[model samples]
Target: MNIRFDGKRALVTGAGKGIGRDVVKKLVECGAETIALSRTQSDLDSLKQECPSIIPVLCDLADSESISTALKDCGPIDLLVNNAAIAICESFFDANTADFDKTFDINVKATIVVSQIVAKGMIERKAGGSIVNVSSQASLRGLKNHLIYAASKAAVDSVTRTMSLELGPHNIRTNAVNPTVTNTAMAKVGWSDPVKVKAMTSLIPLGRFAEVSEVVSVILFLLSDFSSMVSGSCVPIDGGCVAS
Candidate 1:
């Protein structure tokens, strides 16, 4: 199926690097007017250089006020990608309040807040929109040292389902993408050891981790008209890891 987002406006958080960066680039290529939010100005500058059509916004997801201020003048966005997240790997017994708070603030709370703000605009304009939350496979299955991170993402999945029910009346769709260990710099640090890679890959039916583009493809699909009836779902981009 040919999916095109011509004339649509999309906003992606954590758009400075990794999956977010790839999503922004792909959105632009698909003819969408993209607004990218990132904490680093240099990364935004590099993104702008690569895709001149994208509008960059500097925002820290951890702060509630920052999210509101950054999106204040972003105009009406038809697609929202809540992709900003941080993983503080600590065992359940050892995880502290600070780590839990920080993880939830960015991964869960910020996603809800951003979607609320953007959805308000969409409702006001009478133009229904699509929202995709970037969650993790750990949310569905237990992972070592991912206690807090997994919990935060599980909350994200809940938010997706709840929002879909509330927003469906307004013709707004909400969903989440749960990807397994992706080939990104941040993830590479954890899976760098050959033993770790083999152990993890062996469990995946596909016998490989996902590439950033693979995740982006699913994000774009959900955002496009191709997934008009899809909502309140957690689409796994795990290369068959969930299946295994």
Candidate 2:
């Protein structure tokens, strides 16, 4: 299928690196007027330089005020990907309120904040849109040091469902993409040890983690008209890790 977004506008958070960075590039290639949001100016500058026409917004997703102010003039986004997230690896016993608050603020709360800001315009224009929340496979099942991270993602899934239900009437769709340890900077942080990586990979039927393109493909599909009927779903691009 020739998926295109010639005249549409898309906004992606965490566009500084990894999966989020790749998703923005793909959107630009697909003909969308894309906006890349990142807390780091260098990441946005390089992305804009690479994509030329891409708009770059600088905002730290952890701050609700920053998110709101940065995106207030986004102007009727047709697609949004709440891909900004951070993971503080603390075992259940070791986790604290500080880490918990930080995780939820970005992974769960920022997703809601950005979606709400963008969705209001969609509702006003009566134009509808799509939102993809970048959750994690850790959300499905517990992990050793993923206590707070897992909880935040579980909340993201809940957000996806509720938004889909409420926004469906307005022709808006919301979904979550849960990916296993992809070869990204974040993966390096959590899956750095060879022993841990080996142990983790062994559980997946594919015997491997995912690539950025693999996850980006699914995100773009959901953002496009191709996934018109697929909403309120937690789709896993985990190489069957979740299934296995």
Candidate 3:
């Protein structure tokens, strides 16, 4: 069970906190040289304080220019984890147009652009690396008040499948991790209602939320050689929520 990514180079988006931060730390711990990208300098600074070996890059997924600049400095990446995303817990009728645009920009568009740039480098080098897009169970089923967010993630799932097919010939494998109701600060924002939380948890056969480490373990497996033949599929780490 000792999966090691020793000597790999990884770039993780939204590594300022939550799942992204944990993923960067986990990758580094597994022996991959990691570059953490986020819009907040302080968060990146904090990560550096904790792990000085991690290289921090400031990049806003919403800004094309910033993303391009950050990629330029990234040089080449052996593994790309598109983990940045945004959401708003409001009915479709109450959702703001601006928020809708912003949500798609970060959740879908940014993931695509960044992956293309990095995957190109991987292809040219013939490195045949792996891409783990942080998708969600939202893409699998509809959720109340998650109109825009669900749409955005649905696109990610679709893109993952397409990328897998397009990149398969080049030896690049693209897949996604679809997690359900993980106990992250971000997840709490959507599950604040007591009734909603209980209802969602009840649907899960495991009857609980996943720890951040659980999700990180799945990502690590996908990045490592253990999943060398797995691609273009959505692996649900949903506590069996999808089964019920």
Listed in order, each prediction's TM-score against the native is: 0.98, 0.98, 0.98
- Per-residue CA lDDT of model 2 for 6-107, tens digit only, reads 999999999999999999999999999998999999998888888998889999988898887898777779999999999888888999998989889989
The ten-residue window of minimal lDDT in model 2 covers: 67-76
Candidate 3 yields a Cα-based lDDT of 0.91
What's model 3's lDDT at 238?
Answer: 96
Model 1 accuracy (lDDT, Cα): 0.93
Q: What local lDDT does model 2 show for residue 60?
A: 90
**Each candidate: what lDDT?**
0.93, 0.92, 0.91
TM-score of 1: 0.98
The prediction achieving the highest TM-score against the true structure is 2
User: What lDDT score is found at residue 26 in candidate 2?
Assistant: 93
The lDDT ranking, best first, is 1, 2, 3
Candidate 3 deviant stretches above 4 angstroms: none
Q: Evaluate model 3: give its TM-score.
A: 0.98
Lowest summed lDDT across 10 adjacent residues in model 1 is found at 183-192
User: Which stretches in model 2 have alpha-carbon errors above 4 Å?
Assistant: none
Error of 2 at 62 (Å): 1.1
